[model samples]
Target: MIQHFFLLLSIQFRSFFGAVANEWENNRLKLIAGAVTLLVMAGAFFFMFRGLFRYLASLDADLFGFGTALASRLFGMALLAFGVFVGVSSLITGNSALYRSERSTLLMAMPVRRSSLAASSVLQSWFNAGWTMLLMGYPILIAFAEGLEFTTVYLSRGLLLYPLLLLVWLSAGTLLTVLLGWAGGPSGWKLFGGIALIAGCGAVVFFAGGTSSDLIIQEAPGMQLGGLQNFVSDLPGQSRGYWPHSLFLQAMVKGNGNAALILTVEAVVLAAAALTAASWKFLEAWNRSAVAEVRYRSPMFFKDGGRYSTVFQKDLLMFMRDPVQWSQLGLLTGMFAIYVINLGRFPMDFTNPYWLAVGVFINISFSAFAVATMMVRFAFPAPSMEAPGLHVLIQLPRGRELFYGSKWSQTLFLSVIPASILAWFSTMSIGAGPLLQVESVGCIFITAFTLSTINISTGCLFMRKEAGSAVSISSGQGGIISAFASVGFVLFMVGVLSWVTKKYMTDNFTELMLAKPVRDSILYLMLPVGFTVSIASFRAGIKNLRERVF
Candidate 1:
């Protein structure tokens, strides 16, 4: 069994490397785009972390001289957050690999042990989820080391312990996925459980916010080590009963070797336990999943509607059919809620127009980046996601209208509406002027519409059947190009807004509110640019679809 597992693992590794080699040989552009995207992301993460560490290290004036302690706490919170994220990702990817894939079926029919199959799947899931975490994480650690002047030994220890942390998370997630499959859990129950989990997290964060905010609000010396720990713990780690973050912090940053050893042991034990149990129960889980009834039915939302309406309903139903999509959307929503609530909690004066402008800028920047990323993840693969049914779709009369219109409708509901609402609430939370609030929401709508057109256009132009899933499709060359292009547009928009605001808006809220002429000028510049880009992108994408796809 061990040998077979090793062979399976080797095969997985070869498959990954071989795919990379094939892309490098046949589609070098994809390899280059991916490399450029990775470097840009790494650089961004490094700078962001460096800035955060510097701020935490300089928290003496306001945070009561607990700079170092707060920095350590921040480190722990980052690790815990990443761990949880990877775990959730693992559950989604692992479940699919273990039961939903045809390759798994072929493997199960062979003479190999089911244990080997399960073990291989677990390892595969770890690699899939862990690589991103590693790429994003190491840069932060590097920045932390540089910002805090930590020894190289400390950085090395952190690098070593990070994979151990990922192992624990990946194993736990895989175990949960397998356990659910073995228990023959209904899809409804799984959905409900995820909802309950997210809700419970919100409740904990809500309760913790009061206590943590009080420490800062009072301007007491208690806002030192204990207070900082409370803030970090309540937000990420302790909220989920996760302590490895503390262990990693103590071991790596504080030079506590015992904590490091303990974490290592925990990772090993959890991983071994997960592998043994999953392998032992693999047959039963396979049987359970295989025997599960297919209960899907035609969605009746637009059963009797027109062709465009039917396409819209089909897109909506496809999104709803995937539990992973709902879970991810729920997670994004939860994060945004936390972010808006935190904006309200930020210890900054809102009455001053300067501070208000700064807040608005930050809010808009965050929202724009998020919108761009979500577009890449969810919108960039809309056309490719239809690859399996391309033949049927192309045969329809007025197919171009049906396809593009359906995508536009999906973007309106899924991306534009949500982004507009988020912008409205976030700007309101920061107490921006009424005009500024309206402008912010309008900007978000324009941004969302533009990004959706760009990404959906790229999806059509670069539709690939072999990608097989939205996740895979979104990692392609077109997706990378779309992501970068969308982000660059957002940066340009923000720059224009900032320049206009600084050049025209006055220091007082009333003066800024009365600056209608300046606001109108800014809108005139932005609106035309946004519409031009959207129109151009739509035309290009439609041309590609008509020539190649249709």
Candidate 2:
């Protein structure tokens, strides 16, 4: 049985890695080039973070008696954030692994023990969440670890416990999945997304607001020896229910060998115990889930949306039903809200043309970059999203242009309209001139209009019907190409914006040097270019899909 489990896990790992490299099969040269590009990007970020941490280490926190405790606090806070992210990722993915997969039903009817089922599910979640957590944790950990000379115990605990910590989150998340199923029934566990979203938004708002306090505390002068303890204790009391996290901090900051040894033991024992407990209930929980009875749901806080055209309504409903998409969009909206709210609050010197121009420019470009990023996620997947329904649509409608138009209108309603409002608010948030405000909105509108059409058109051109699952679809080569194209287009816009700003700046601070009308003219010129590209792309794509599908 154990051998069988291990074999299954090995296959699962292969599938996951193969999915990541799914684009590599076609062209050897392209694969090599991609590998190089990814490595370069990773290396650039890693070294950049390392340099920042080294600088932070050099900063004299002597004012606050931060001498030794500063490292401990940093270690604690960073690990806590990382662990929360891992846990949520595990919870979301694990829920899908347990509930959404038909394999659960198949396995349930077999002779498989609940223990085996739970163990396999937990391991799969760990595998899914592990690489991401490691990649994110490593640069921060490695940078900090450099300063703390690695003793044998520190090396053992640090290397072992960080991964152990991730395992703990996976195990706990799996257990939560079981409980949610038990309480809510089959699809009941998905309610976790709602809870997670609320918590995440509150966290963003708090995090955004707390930066001022951190800055103040760091700068405040109070360098007596006792103040160090006071400073550390001043933080809100942490529950420390998660021992791996606590031990990680202890090992890093206090250099406690006992804590490290105990942590290693606890991690191994607790991992087994949690999985066993979860397995104890897994069969019963899954049986209840398989029944598919309708459990009562609480009243929704918001009313449903109004009806649009049939095609648009269908796409809108489809997008709303997917928890994965909603969660991502919710996070984006929350972060954007935090940014916009803080933009008005963060004081900028209007008297200094350099600061004023640069601040407003960054704020405007930030809005553009943000909308494009959101579109890549929401819009670019348009074609792949239709794979399951493509045959049905072809048999019924046979109107390719109508279908594409519906998507275009839905994209405007979903992505473009909201984004334009946000961009205008962001521009006004920083007190830009009336002309600048209008220009900012037009630029975003052009970006949204072009990107939306581009995504659907390019998506149709490269759509992969064989990639049945959302994860596999996004990993497909077509999706990758679409994303790269969107990014490149965004960069072109940012570059143009930067050049115009620079040109205007170098003209002796004369407001007339770059006249409002001229600036408007240059931006207006972009609309025609965007219009030409969108027409060509949209036409070719609809033509191809119509011929191929209908």
Candidate 3:
């Protein structure tokens, strides 16, 4: 059974690598862009850790010692949270896909026991959970210990601790999936569970953030470390029940000490036990319940409804019906909210219009990127969603161009217009003057056009297949590529606008300030050209789609 489990895991790993490699081959430029992105992210992490460590090192010896312990604890908490996030998202997405694949159909028919099949599946999930954790964690670990010697203690502790963290995350995810799978039906339960998990994680982050702040304050001059040391000492006793994070922290601070070793062993043992039990019980239920097909029947239509209007309504209804579409929009909205909140926190001198203009431009850029990304992910997948039904549509009196035009029109109405309104509102709220306001409006229009074109192009390029379940991050590289390209385009445009604004300010600040109409007029000129180019791109994409089989 163990051998079979290992064999299955090996096959899964190879399959994953092959999928990634194929994506890299198809989108080599985008893959390279992603690598560059990872590098930039790594650099940012390194600098952040360097600054943090430097600050810690500069403290008084007593304070440094206490802060180190606190930092370790907070880091452990972060690791646990990251693990949970990766584990939950992976387990849910993977289980949904696996349930659809019904791979158990083949495995169940084998000479092997059901328990072994379940174990193998669980192990596959663990690999996924572990890989996702490592992607973010390894960079952090490297950054945290920058300029430090490679001691055996550091290596051994990390090796032991990370596995425990992975186990904690995987076990928790497995247990949650099992419990949720048992619930059955698309009740409000899934939404409630998602909200609860997010809220719980947010609360943990807030507490950890506060604790970190306190630790920093304690490192200030003339502050005694006694209280801090006492707090650290009490934490271990109080957190005895929360062994995963505690044990990981202990291992980090004390390395391979007997206490740390014992905690590590306990965590691993508990994870294994929980996983075994969850797999044995959950697999049977999952196989049976997961295959139940859901049929959504539309309400009866009114006889007087116009065909064009009906098409639009159908597109809107379908968009709302898909949870993934709503989720993407929700994420973008959440990001925009965060951006606005952070911008409000900035203490800017309103007397300097340049500062306000810069703020508005930054906010607009963020909104544009968010809008473009959401459009590509949600709108581009529309054609694929048509599936076998597309043949029926193609056989209709109208050309495919008309069908494509209707879809694009729907995207413009539902995605583009809302995004533009939000961007303009955000800019105006940031106190942009009439000239800046006009420029902002033009920017929003251009952004909407660019996003629409990119989304349509992506739709034409990538043929969507029904993987029989919810989308996973690892499913395709097309969305990632489109997202990256959208962000890059936004950055490029924003950079040019910033440069033009700066040059205008430097060359004739007073004149430009006084001649608001002239400056606004120049900005508005960009709109027509942008719209023309975007429309042309959309048409080109349609032409490409006609040539392709999909």
Count clashes in each candidate, considering only residues at least 3 apart in sequence or on different chains. Answer: 0, 0, 0
lDDT of 1 at 210: 29
Q: Which residue pairs clash in candidate 1?
A: none
lDDT for predicted candidate 2 compared with the true structure: 0.63
lDDT of 3 by residue, 1-550 (tens): 6777776667777888998799788978877876776676567666776567445544435554454544455455566567656555544543443343456667666776656666667666666556646666766665545523222226457655676666765666565555555555222335336534643554454334333233333456765545445444433211333445555655654563655666667657756775566566555566555654446677676435865677766776676666544654664466466655455445454345566656766676766676765676566666666654666666666547756777677777776666666666666666666666556666666776677677666666665655322244223455555565566667766765675566546755442453544354445545555666577767777877677664
Give the candidate number with the greatest TM-score.
Answer: 1
Give the clashing residue pairs of candidate 3, or none.
Answer: none
**lDDT on C-alpha atoms for all candidate structures:** 0.74, 0.63, 0.58
Question: Model 3's lDDT to the true fold?
Answer: 0.58
Over 4 Å off, model 3: 1-4, 7-88, 109-111, 126-171, 185-192, 203-208, 211-274, 291-295, 300-308, 316-321, 324-328, 331-358, 428-441, 465-475, 500-529, 532-536
Error of 1 at 396 (Å): 3.0
Regions of model 1 farther than 4 Å from truth: 51-77, 150-153, 185-242, 334-359, 429-431, 500-506, 509-514, 517-521
| Candidate no. 1 TM-score | 0.85
- For model 1, how does the per-residue alpha-carbon lDDT over 120-224 read when each residue is reduced to its tens digit? 887777787688888889999888887675333388898899889888877777777777787773244584364346345435534452234322322565333
* TM-scores for every predicted model: 0.85, 0.71, 0.68
* lDDT, candidate 3, at 349: 42
The CA lDDT at 4 in model 2 is 56
lDDT of 2 by residue, 15-75 (tens): 7779657756656666776566556545655676556555545543443434333444555
* Model 3 vs. true fold: TM: 0.68
